[model samples]
Target: MSLLETLAGKGLRREPPTRDEALALLATSDDDLLDVVAAAGRVRRHWFGRRVKLNYLVNLKSGLCPEDCTYCSQRLGSKADILTYTWLKPGEAADAAAAGMAAGAKRVCLVASGRGPTDRDVRRVADTIAAIKERGDVEICACLGLLRDGQGERLRDAGAHAYNHNLNTSEAQYGDICTTHDFGDRADTVRRSRDAGLSPCSGLIAGMGETDGDLVDVAFALRELDVDSVPVNFLIPFEGTPLAGQWALTPQRCLRILAMVRFVCPDVEVRLSGGREIHLRSLQPLALHIVNSIFLGDYLTSEGQAGQADLDMIADAGFEVEGADVPTLPEHRREAAPARDAAPLADAVPVPDAAPVSGARADLVAVRRRGAGTELPPNA
Candidate 1:
């Protein structure tokens, strides 16, 4: 069988891909990109069908972060010219979340920037979660940096359904991206959230000047974590952050990364997270075939396409916006957690980066100018 066939068959059975198989998929040529997407699409459709789950970001707090993770525009000591603000009042946050739910967001991701939340911070966010839950049937996912021992349980008790702390890159290449916390710190948080009965939602960022092996390593690690969702983010390379001018991904490469994530963790909600508008560009529609979830409207530090445009694209691409009542995962996955075995990354094989994307439009790396912190209407 072809490599695609081998991996897709395994994915259909909810089997994890070997690290070498994942590396080979990443190494597939631009000429075979469509075939690779087609193969991954088979697995996507099997578990998710034609449904696209929409999640919205509510930047409960913005900027002024203590950690110096290089890719972020919000990190300390940076001059990204992005919006900076403290916690939004619970009513203000609920109002912001209501704007997105009106536009068909099934979940509202409540995000705050910091090393971790204090007990006071947790209570504040829990209050916001209660306020949002009062509004309707929306799911609340908290991304409040790392968690203390009881914060996950506290959020879970407050009607939060999931917790997001992305394993942003591979364990091997993690220090290259951020050093305030190590890979173990991230993995431990995911485990704590899972133990707290909050669905684990973690993922990775591509185009951070990582090698192909580094990308493969990220996918396998997420599988081992057995997360309920995998958000594949393309690096936005904000001009003021350390990754400024790092426009290394083509639309084809973005699709390959999504496909690889799908093959590695087939049953999870593989989301086309931040930077889809910039990196995927005209190819965004094709990505829908590989991913079942996406953020609606604006991201935390940047803006996505208009909400109506996102809806129109889903219709144009022959898919439906997955309903709020619909569960994102397969019945088996939602019924019970499965055991996950780690797949070790092969250190001997290092694949070079793809050639630089010519005419990578720097204009697409826009700073968020409105919504949460501004008087303007939220994008959704």
Candidate 2:
């Protein structure tokens, strides 16, 4: 069988790809990139069909992180001027989640940035999760840095459905990104979350100056760890961070990475997380064919396409939003487009829940602006 055929067979069986098989997907020639994506799409369809899960991020706490993850704008000793605040109050967190739910998101990710949450911090997030649960039927995922002993059970009891901790790169490449924590520390957390009966949502960040071999290693590792969700984040290379000048990604390359993750993980939820807009550009809709989930609006510290546009994107791609009917765009509204050469989606809060409207929204103007690259930080 061809590599793609063999990989698809393994994916159909929900079998993990061997390291060699995973590496071959990454080594695919640029000329054959689309073929790889199409093969991966077959596997994606087998698992998720045409349904796309929309997730919304609630930045419960921002900045003030002590770890020096070089690609992050919020790391210690960095000078990025993103928002900095203590944890949001429980009601505020619920309100943010409500905004996402209004935009058709099925899951609310509550994220905080730090080494790990204290016992008290875990309770606070649990309270926020409880409040959000009280309001809607949304699944709650917590992205506090690391979970100490018993913290996962506390979160699960508080109504959290999952916990997110990303293995942002391979074991060989971990030190190049963050020295404050080791890769084994991340693996341990995933294990703890699973033991506590919480779904493990872990993923990786690409284009951090790592070799293709490193990418394959991480994909297979995620399979070995058996995480429930895998978020594939492209590096934003935010200015003022250590990796600011590393512009090594192209749209086609990003697609190849997503396809590789899909073939390796098979039935797991592969999310087109964080750097989708900036990195994927016009090909954003095509990514939906290979990955089953995307954040609904602005990321924790960065911005994204308007929620309406995201909804439209899902509809335009002929994919239905999971758990809700996709809203149809009126003919006149279809003619309206974001301002040409508009600003990047940053700093602006996502649209709050509002009444249904006809045509493109008059307030939905896109202008080109500069600052932090748009991103969705892993729930931590």
Candidate 3:
């Protein structure tokens, strides 16, 4: 069988791809890219159909973070000329959320920039969650960095449906990106989220100078964790961060990364998050076949594509926006019936050889001048 055929078959069966198979998907030639996507698209359809879940971000706090994650525009000591502000009041955050929901976003992610949330910060987010709930029905996901002993439960009690803390990259290379925290800390938080009855939303970022092996390692790790949502982010390479001008991803590379994640975590919600606009560029419509979810507009400190443009892209790509009433997970992973015959852990496999990556467009990264924490009207 062809590599794509083999991987697609494994994905449909919910079998974890061997490390070699995952790396091979990343090394496939650009000429074979569409076939790879078509194969993974089959798995995406089996689980998610043609529905694209729209998620919106409301940056409750921006900049002044203590953790120095190398790729983040908001990381401490970074000169990235992005917005920096204190937490948004509950009413202000509610207003921001209403706009995204009006544009058909089903989930509102409340994010803050910090090492982690303090007890008071968690309470503040609870109030913001309450205010956003008052506006209309929307799934609430809090992305405050790291969780203390009981913070996840507190967020859940306040009506949070999910919590996001990205593994960002492989454990082997985790320290290279940030040292204030470690990979074990991230895994612990995901465990905390799941134990607290909040849907675990963890994922990774690409184009941060990681090798193909690193990407595969993280994808398989997330699979083992069984996180409900896997957000695949491309590094934005903002002009001021330590990774400034680091452009390691091309459109094809981005697609391949998304395809590899799909094959590794076939049944989960694979979301095309940050940096899609710059790296994926015009090929984003193609990615709809791979990822079932996307951020609607504006990342924490950078501008994304226009919100209306996102809707148009979904339509043009022949996918429907997943409604708020629709469940994001397959029936087996849903909260109502959580039990399942857990698949046996795949055997340890050696990392495959690294794949060749191509050039990136340095001109594409744009700092956020509007949206939350700004005077200009926020994009939906």
- TM-score to native of every candidate shown: 0.89, 0.86, 0.89
CA error at residue 71 for candidate 1, angstroms = 0.2
Q: All models: lDDT?
A: 0.82, 0.78, 0.82
- Candidate 3 matches the true fold with a TM-score of 0.89
Return the lDDT, model 2, position 376. 32
Candidate 1 backbone collisions, by pair? none
What would the per-residue lDDT of candidate 2 be over residues 20-120, giving only the tens digit for each residue? 88887877787887778788889988877888888888888888899999988779987775767788889877776776776667778999989999998
The Cα error of candidate 1 at residue 106, in Å, is 0.6
Model 3 segments more than 4 A misplaced? 335-380
lDDT of 2 at 152: 87
Q: List the residue pairs that clash in candidate 3.
A: none
For candidate 2, the 10 contiguous residues with the lowest summed lDDT are 359-368
Give the CA lDDT, 0 to 100, for residue 180 in model 2. Answer: 96
